[model samples]
Target: MDFFAYLTRFYLPFAFFVMGESMQGISIKPGILVLVGNKQLEIIDSVSASKIRARDLTTGEVLLISPGEIEFELKKAAPMSNPNSGQTERTSLIESANEADIELASDRYDVLLPIAGKRPISKKDMIQCTEALKLSASQVYRLLDKLDTNIGPLSLLPQRRGRVKGVKLIEASAEDTIQEIIDQHYDGPGITYQEIFEKVKEQCLAKSIPVPSEATVSNRLRERNPRALMAKKYGSKAASQEFEVRGGKVLPEEPLELIQIDHAEVDCIIVDSEHRQPLIRPWVTLAIDVYTRVILGLYLSLSHPSTMSVALCISHAILPKERWLKLIGMPDGEYPFYGVPKRVHVDNAKEFKSKNLEDSCRKYDIKLTWRPKGVPHNGAHIERYVGTLMTRVHMLPGTTMSSTKNRRHYKSEQHAAMSFSELREWLIREVEIYHKTTHSELKCSPLHKWESHFKSKNGRFSYPSIVDDQKRLLIDFMPFKKRTIGRDGVKLHTIDYYSPTLKRFNIGSRCIARYDPEAINKIWVLPEGEQNYIEIGYADLRLPNATLSEFKRAGAKLRADSKRRVPAAEVFKLIRKNDALVNSAVACTKEMRRMRERKKTRLTDSGHPLNEKNAQQVKMSTSPSPDYSVKPRPYDIEE
Candidate 1:
């Protein structure tokens, strides 16, 4: 029998977080009302660490049970109905409140803000709250407890002192219970609403509560947010593509007004940097200006698309690219496209929705908007450009040619000659070519269109939106975490950071810590209520700088080997071991590829028994390479 077969025998209780730092998730204390299966219960007392004494809201019977027996729910507040109108008592309080009530609530909110979520408020803090609000210690505790009912300033609003005559109370409805079950079960897998309704009936029967009608359940399911439902059933990307409106292209007024960023897997196999062995196709994250159709910035990596990829792409798009172009060994090449876009449009991908990306965009006053949930045409600008780029990619050696049908009889891996760095350099040169080529829609080169917009007219030119503090711009783009500054500074990913500047801030104050994923040996900490961040390095500065990728891979290996709580030192040791192993493999692979290439070259030179025509074809395909050399000149000069 399945575990759920016995689920009906016992009721699911509301889960609670124990009063300690060791426990995680939302906290539940005494006096709070929670649902056990379908029945409402008030948390009356903590009888033991695992068991709690709760009173049944209906029967007023006090019973002791483990907190684990309950399920956590987002909607737990019991509705209190008015006698005349059947609406919750405090539902409209925030909106319908008088000016006097709003002002009073605001004052109370300020006084309690510091200690609102802090459990077991310190004696010193309790005295201060009493002094500031002119309320007793018990009153302060009661007010804080009220926050558990509903987490808002409305929870602190003035209410009637006593229950009014003919007033009615309502518990969590049977319809709501059915809806919760539907939300949980009717997604991802093929679970029907009928089956969900049956399960609800079983649970309700066990808990001795009235079951909701199937029609009620159906109505609830229909009322779910369509986008949210589709996202759960399929995926965020699919939901966006299906529901987004395919309106006509809305062009930006000028350059850098609207930029679109998206990732695509290059349709060609590439080789490794050291071994030149055929590696998996790399992914390129590209950002393009909508108005001019100019490539703003791009990041190429072997890793899949992630928050780091988007962050790097945005940073590249904002900063001047002269140094980057030179670093890729294209010193003479020109790529002038760089500026902070007024708005950036992206698909409904998880990386784009990350808090770090949102915060960084907010700081720069850049609008980060998601393309609508349904239509592919909504993101046509980026998609069309990617399609055009991939068409050119098919012309290169070792090209996969978009699909398997087009790649028939061709062994891409065998002909794969370009290394990752070589591919990157080729991509940069290709971008330059793309900018010079006449666009089908514009009837002129993208470079020309871009130049005309920023060119001096009436002794004035539209300068790009450049940031003054370039260093801070990059730092803001990095992934960040929130942690409290403790006695030993702050700990993130099991690593300690410390600095003298941290001493000025109060101990146990929560601060935002942003770190460079490339080298996380140091971090920048933004203390609470402060505008700028202070640099903090590892407590043990001797520790080697480790990339975020290495840390994740090492941590994963440890977890797979059943080491749940491996120390930071052990993980670093594993990272070093992994590096050495890769280096050793690189040497062996290089020698093997060298021997194979020599045999192929000899065959071509001697005209072996293999078909002469086929041999010639292979030679032609493999012999010719692009001329990467470009004469140094100003970007304004035409080819």
Candidate 2:
């Protein structure tokens, strides 16, 4: 509902802005909140305050608020996961760069080499030399064969067209070639030999100077300066994902030596479309700096939330001001950032494996390290946050559901997923609030520490200038699918997948699969995906737990259910009846026997339990195996 209508219904004294209490029912958890009384407001509860906020209720005027909002806002004791990308940047660095006396750039490397080093070379050393000289890729490979002075006396340069300037190629003493490098913009971005050739041809054609045929002119140039005629294509453009952090004065540390990163999937499942119920939410990617205990980046996405997202999160959260700008090649007014971190802590998620993200770290000399799989404890810091989210936000009553409409009948249903948009917003607000408040993990508010640590009285420490290289971190998509193994193959969302991987796990078993974003030929088995994809494990299936009342009633209805003619119904009835019989008022005497047998059995068959023959002396009372429903009891109501 709109704010006006909501305020009117509540009969609130004054208009108030609600920061994140938009949700209808998030106040089911425990928390102490402030409330107004006959005179003034008062602080409520939370055993022994611990840096958490609580206004001086006795001094301020009473502020009337709903109980639900109070609990929802205050009772928010659960853990939270947020995107790691640093959203803030320094503006002062930009002003400084623009006002700097001179533009910063590496000196041209051409001055370092001898004239003999110029040749058509294609060796690794030659490529390095070309790069060192600030030469283009075309220049690099063209001079490959001429890498060493010992190889040849002359070197090759990539060919290009140019125009004649003063002296014409044909008329000016066939011994020499003359051309002007006109900026046609056609020979590519830089000034090259091609432009001079094109200029020479045009100038000769227009003037009285005799122009030679294209072939004769070319042959003359090649014969006179063959080493400069080596042709090379421009190198193919490629990009990778990266995140950067630099230790202050404070130098960056070695890879993984000082940094480790970890990530987690959000607890709530998100709707595929606002109209449809949520598919399951994928992972929540996070990167942390181990030493500082700072979150480097956080990313929330519906796709599997790959390695790139994690890297992007790290990129968003922190950057080494100078290196980031240098790597990106940004202009003065563009990007600004605070200090970078020394190390990054992460889990085994592939996003951390991003070659692109790694390259970014390498460029800036930042370290990136990851933990092995199945070791949640290793990433305990982030795991603690993820756990809190699961217990508080995800498990909250009437909070998450297939959709808004689904919540209306939520009491009847076991649980529901959340909409993606809603989930994203919740995470952001939660994180922002988390940063605002102090945390147990860092023993202080993250924002307070981060700002205090990096910010100066004048302004924030040097900030990064975003470059194309910095922005080149690739984001990719991997569509989801669901399945279970059937005799014929693995069935995903009713679709059959017959692969060698599935054969090992076999049919009749459900599995989740996602295609690789980089390569379509391979697929990955996941624990869960957005709704349309296969749900992986038992918990992912959203299996409903049997309530205490349901269990009791199911046992009591055994007699009536046994009369059902349907075999399946009858079977359930018999099973229920047996459960009751084992624990019936008449079976109190049998309990003692069952107990003795349970205690005596040291071991049993591979997959089955112990026999229940010892539960009763009556030969007819025997059952083949231990009862699935029965449990040890100290007292028997039957007695």
Candidate 3:
């Protein structure tokens, strides 16, 4: 975009990052909670992303995005500012207490927080308990007023005590005192809850089941809790504003169009069985339906970020192009393939903003959305998704192997590589699993909603909702590059390339280059008119061969009088020309002899081999012994 254009688009939108309301203390690495509505149609991402003003990456039933996606999800949920948007306990559910329910809520909180959490109490239960009990929302306060269950910082159930070792109990309950001792000691003896209860109650008999009345007490006391729990008292809640973003302002929620696509590189290394040490970077492509916070499609590859990979990813995965898109990750799908998104959101990755991709998107009426510069967190939705990638796509079968995607090696140590097929299988499996598994961060399993969504939509996935035709999908864009043939006729980065026509035509000019990195060195170059690819660069192309005959001939003729050095060049030249190389060869040989004679001074009268030189310098070669028995032969023989 030009100055004004940039101002109208990226720069203007980015200006929000500086807004007090925009950069509201959000962090690049913000805590996120992806929660699913009860209806399962509405997906919400509650971000602590106080930095940028944006929402979840996907919301449309399903989506396939890039690898290295990090998404936080609430295993449990609660309400946010919007009643439509509520928070849930990612770990457990907590509900506020009603008026009468305040005491109950407090009781529940006291009982649950130590183990489960507040929301474990149902919402209807909260409303009814509060209404019936006439407890205000000040549940904790009300709880403290009534429960005889008092301990510092914590009000336990009047029922029993948590036996924390080295911890003293005030207003001790008989059960608690014994339980504390039991908790501290018990490895040697298995003390069932029943046994503990019986002993504490000063009762006897072995079949240690809790008395039905005290079952709740025993159950609450025995349950193990995570170190943290939801607050019994309500924290400040977010307002329920149905803000629709438009013209740098919040408006009514409607016209959910733009979709975001980006690539997230995981900290994991790309490896397979073949190349143990992966040097190239493999990335995953992800597309999110902004309005729905759904992952539409994902593609993982051991290739660089290129138009081809992006195009192929979208082509193979994302289905039903009825949805109108402003920009897609790629430009345009090849003919016969349909379905195009309205807009594609991506970073300034070269592959994303590439001209080819741009042209394709333009051809298909897709709009490209670029995030603000230097504000990566601006795309926090996608960034969050990237965090979950592990090198080992799945846990190694019955082994203690560290995840390849996850780092187990010393960060400083190099890793081995994996074969292309192995890598491919791993990637495919990861994508498959991702589509199937409930997103660890997406409050609910996206796939579950996906099938239902596809079914309810009548299999229509297009904008305005049209029936999807997956078979019609086409290539939107493909990565391309130009390379020159070296004089050696070998392509760089290519170990093997060949085209009988190229060698026959013997013409080397600019040509399109394509190669499968997994295949390594095996490349194909397409000439302007050629329909097929020509592989170049092989073992034969790289090796150098002249001749050794000349050296052998020279050694056969011991030159006694000559003045040139080792005469390697002259010897080679004579061998090729078949000229009177004798004189030249003799000169070279004689020179070598003279140099050897000069360098050697340690000689015995009998001219025995000397060891005065460093032991490493001497070399012995196998040869026939001089025929002294018949007649001594000259050390340098003339053939």
* TM-score of each model, in listed order: 0.52, 0.29, 0.32
TM-score-better candidate, 1 vs 3: 1
What lDDT does candidate 2 reach at residue 478?
30
Residue-level lDDT of model 2, residues 576-597, one tens digit each, is 4544554454433433333222
Q: After superposition, how far is residue 294 of candidate 1 from its true place, in Å?
A: 0.7
Return the TM-score for candidate 3, rounded to 2 decimals. Answer: 0.32
Q: Backbone clashes per model, in order?
A: 12, 83, 116
lDDT for each residue of candidate 1 in 199-291, tens digit (9 for 90 to 100): 888877877788777776676677788788788877887787778665565788999999999999999888755556786687899999999
Q: What's the candidate order when arranged by decreasing TM-score?
A: 1, 3, 2
Candidates sorted on lDDT, descending? 1, 3, 2
Residue 582 of model 1 has an lDDT of: 51
Model 3: residues with Cα > 4 Å off, grouped in runs: 1-257, 269-281, 291-294, 318-339, 391-419, 436-443, 457-476, 479-639
Worst 10 residues of 2 by lDDT: 78-87
Off by over 4 Å in 1: 1-248, 458-462, 499-506, 559-564, 585-639
